[model samples]
Target: MPTQGLEKSYSREHIARQVQRLGEEISRDYAGEELLVVCVLKGAFLFFADLVRAISLPVNVDFVRVASYGPHTQTTGLVEFRKDLEMSVTGRHVLIIDDILDSGFTLEALYQKLAGRKPESLKTCVLLDKRQARQTAFEADYVGISFDSGFVVGYGLDYQESFRSLADIYLFDPAQSV
Candidate 1:
């Protein structure tokens, strides 16, 4: 695998701290309300697990699998719904958790689909936001980190289905490695 250009971006400790803070904020904002925590599958599996454990509020968990990138560094701009939620979001406070906000197409598509179901309120949370790569105007309600560029892997994020188990985030440049 081309792991030569991998460079550490966010340490595991740093990610844990940020996730804890985000959880506290979420728990405070939704004080007395129950949350339908939806995890965008595959990439968000790890972040979703940690985030839900951090929040103190009552949470119901569900999973949806969507794909825009298939073993590629850039998005294909077409969001494919691989798996649908098993529970209904009608009149419920729904929060979508994703690994990263890059081109925004995948998140936006998912958001719109859920919105059509008439949730009482809908929000988004992403572990990382790459503002410069946005092809749509979608913005996450909660964001852990923001950066302008570079492909990142690890801590639930992956490149070609690899590096997701790494303890920290890393900048990976495929062109510079073999």
Candidate 2:
């Protein structure tokens, strides 16, 4: 349990196991389909790298850079694209991989943008689902774990651009965040 300082809740091995299971599920579901993995970059980078290799089927990986947080501790409810995908995404099976689903604003916004491209199917996968007041109706097709906590900073999640390198998932101090 996290308290004063950042503390581990799940180890790296545990995360790897969960990701392997997710890969199996994806392989089973989309066996013969055209699969394109859209990795939301910065945080999702680490998990995306691990997950794709675990899948037994052929898949293509693309990346999109989105930003909502500035120097603050919470989301600004706004998504700005730092980078976009190169693929057309027209009539192809698209799988969006995000590091976490916090308030859902960023993911929802991304989903809407991707929807405009008209894919054959759009599925979202998340590493962590932070139990908060999410404003979107969009649900994650694949979820690693759920947690009710303050801002976490590990396993690609961070605070003020730090702590993303930790292999374990951890909760940062509530008082330390803005």
Candidate 3:
């Protein structure tokens, strides 16, 4: 790990405060509607856990695993569903939670797929948005941080399935590429 490639981007406290704000926003907006918290698995596990708990209202939680990045840092723009949601999202306010929105492929594809299900409402929530890495067209409905695009890892983001244990987000050095 090259210390030079690393940059302190989001601290744990900063991330938490933003999450709290996001929760409050949701609390106010969907005051009466029943909510479904859909956690995109793997990367979103940590963020999802924190977010659902921070929320003040009752929420139905479910985990769905999807894959677009396979053995690569860059996305192929193909989204695949490895696991589907176990709960019914037929007619409820659903929130799609994700860790980072790097390329538009995953989220956009998901939105399209879920849209066909006819949910009462569908919205997105991302912890970090690499607003620059987008190639296709997609945007997060609620974003915690708008960060410069970079190979960032930590919090819930990982590199080669490593560094998921770091409490804060750190940048990745391109020089470390194999």
Stretches of candidate 2 exceeding 4 Å from the true structure: 1-4, 174-178
Count clashing residue pairs per candidate: 0, 0, 0
- TM-score for candidate 2: 0.92
Per-residue error at 71 for model 2, in Å?
A: 1.4
Comparing 2 and 3 on TM-score, the stronger one? 3
Which candidate has the top score in lDDT? Answer: 1
Better of 1 and 2 by lDDT: 1
Residue-by-residue lDDT tens digits, candidate 2, 1-178: 2234666788899999999999999999999876999999899999999999987888989999998987777889888999999988999999999999888889988998998999999999998888764667667899998887667778887777788888898877757544
- Candidate 1: misplaced stretches above 4 Å? 1-4
Error of 1 at 71 (Å): 1.9
Q: What is the Å distance of residue 121 in model 1 from its true position?
A: 0.6
lDDT of 3 at 90: 89
Of 2 and 3, the candidate ranking higher by lDDT:
2
Candidate 2 weakest lDDT stretch, 10 residues: 1-10
What shift in Å separates residue 74 of candidate 3 from its native position after superposition?
0.9
